[model samples]
Target: MSLHGLEEYLPSLVQFCLSVLRISLPLSLAAIAGFWSERSGTPQVGLEGFLLLGALAGATLVKLTDSMPMGFALTLMIGAAGGMLFYWLACRIAINAILVGLIFNLLIAGIAPFITKLIFGSTGSTPTLDPALRWQFFPYLWAAGILIVSLILFHRTGFGLLVKFAGLKPEVISSAGFSLSTVQMCSLILCGVISTSGGFILSTYLASCYSPMMSAGRGFMALAALIFARWDLPRTFAMAIAFGFFEAAQIYLQSVNSPLPSQFYQALPYLMTLVVLGLRRQGLSEMA
Candidate 1:
């Protein structure tokens, strides 16, 4: 590319970063949800399901009404409630945490399409949202708030301590006279709300519509980020952003002319994910 062409692309590059930020916000939010759930020793892999469920809920409500914000509000409330209910059931049963989560994912995957069929007369998607109702900065503002609230909840409160204890050392929680049920339930509810909020953000800001499997493995990606960050909120946030950048770059590259096969570009994000995680792991090992 000529210098003049490069100069022209600079503006597009800057715009790309902005898009990365927008995409990263929801991933960070979802990773933080994993952090909360894992800290309570109840890691939920069903986060993908919750996100799809929330997206479905938000889209359905918006389709039925003229208010986008109202749909988002109801989505969060119902997501949290559903999460709490799942936690309650898990506590009463003797299922493996991972298995329980997988079950939830399966359930949501089925239900989302079924509901879509009922509402839209198809098993595919909801209508595109009105552009006027969408805010370009909504994801960024919510991302900041999610990080701040997570910091306060995990680092500065007794509830946070109990939640951490539930994961790190259940005996300590018992010794402190804190019931495991309470901590687990709280963690799951928060996880549900935040993760679903991430879903809402993605549906509104990224896709601008809800569709079957719209989450596209983002929840699992968030979980990978959570583990990559060793369950720390701040580091997980950065890692999630990094993953989002990789995803954004994939989209950008796809739009540009290149001899590379489309399949290569499609695989780029996950490839970069492994590369970034490998680098982080190597660096951590060197430091150790």
Candidate 2:
């Protein structure tokens, strides 16, 4: 608590905050993507697929073009296209949306290695990108900006209301003279576009290359946060930050000497997620 101690602690505190933001950025984005998808009545269980796709697109584009912005732009375009494909398969066809999402995840997982091999002559990952091409703090701004814009769009626009109706009451949307399927498709496409930023950050900001399975279940974690928050955008964001804090702690604990095994520390964030979800379910049961 002394002045010199405070000065030393200040740097550590700042670094921890930065760490949390870096860790949370992707989860937050994915949660928001899930928000849009589920809010519009489409299950987005394939968020993991989108995250991996983004990571691959971002690392590949940045390595090929050597421009971060260009890489990001192309990644978003790919995401939008992927979203359309998902809508066609899940919505347009007679299959169930959840099953379609699961199948999509499996399909992406199976092809990613082949895609990497075809593009980079490697079955594992894309080549490492230039560190200079990697983003640092700007991604935080981008995440924050996306969150704000999404909030505005969802709460302040008629489009948002239509999307909401598409989820909660399709009959209402139909009564309003808007095509229900159109609203759902648009929401899913936006979901795809937004979710890509998370993977882009994973490859461009957190690491230099796209590795296989780099998403490591963050997509599902984001979904849990979204569901726990009951599809509330702001609350989902907060849950993501909380998860990020646990992940940051896990990383920090690994760096310092500790009596516990490394796996325990590594599992800290996920364990925390399970705990939070359990608590939410318990709370709901009690209320019920």
Candidate 3:
């Protein structure tokens, strides 16, 4: 953070921006994933599941084939499959989407360890990834592309309108001749692929390996961020970046051996998120 050093040292502002990107990119993706699902009127509680599965898939595939592209393709395929499965059960069986999501989250908790054990012959995690082999800037580019695409999709297309209608008024969408299943399916698939990428980013860049519990409730954090932003994409994106900054601060604090309780450093991001959300809610009430 000191700017008085040699020209060799990058400016503090530049370093801060990079750290923020590293921390927030995943959250941005997760928020957008939630946005896509809810924008279509479908409740998404499965983001955590989607994210963990993606991380597992990425780590396993990269380990097997030593190809990041292969890992990404395979992760997307698996995400798509999971999304469709959830859609079928939620749509056909009349189960609440939130319940289905909770089941999937539990499913991830069960299956990630099982797979990790089978592959590594132990529990907790796989082998640590080499820095050169880990994904670096690609996920950032992908996140930006996704945000742009989402903004255009929501504002520029009739299909986007249908997606909105489906969520707010299924009868109206149906009357307009749009199949509710189709809209939900598309959104869920997007949600799966996008949300899972959050895990992918965390594993490949943040940790260098996939662990069963690596995400550590970030998916839920993203959900909370979305709620706080009232589903507005720009605000959601900003809030996610803010959360990322706190996470970055946590990481920095950990390294400095700060006198603060380690527990407080760990809780910093979540605490900040709660405080900001409360403030946002209070401001909204005052405006009313």
How large is the C-alpha RMSD of every model relative to the true structure?
3.8, 2.8, 3.6
Q: Candidate 2: where is the Cα deviation over 4 Å? A: 257-288
- The prediction achieving the highest TM-score against the true structure is 2
Model 3 local distance difference test score: 0.80
Better of 2 and 3 by TM-score: 2
Angstrom error at residue 25, model 2: 1.0
lDDT of 1 by residue, 1-288 (tens): 999999999998899889899878777888888888888888678889888877888877876776877887898898898778678766647477788889989998888878878888877788888888787676788789989998998999999888878887788887888798888988889999998888888787787889889888888888878776777889889888888887777777778865776667446546755676676735552111
Please write out the lDDT profile of model 2 over residues 1-288, one tens digit for every residue.
Answer: 799999989999999998998888888999999899998888789899999989988998988888999989999999999889988988888478888879878988888899899988998789988776667578999899999999999999999999888877879988878898899889989999989888899888988899999998888888878877778899999989988887788778778876777677456556765776676635552211
Worst 10 residues of 1 by lDDT: 279-288
TM-score of 1: 0.88
**TM-score, model 3 to reference:** 0.87
Q: Write the per-residue lDDT of candidate 3 for residues 186-275, one digit (tens) a residue.
A: 988888888877777777777778987787777887877777777789888988898787777777878888777667755655676577
- Highest lDDT model number: 2
Error of 1 at 176 (Å): 0.7
* Cα shift from native, residue 230, model 3 (Å): 0.2
Report the error of model 2 at residue 278, Å: 5.4
Better of 1 and 2 by lDDT: 2
Off by over 4 Å in 3: 1-10, 254-288
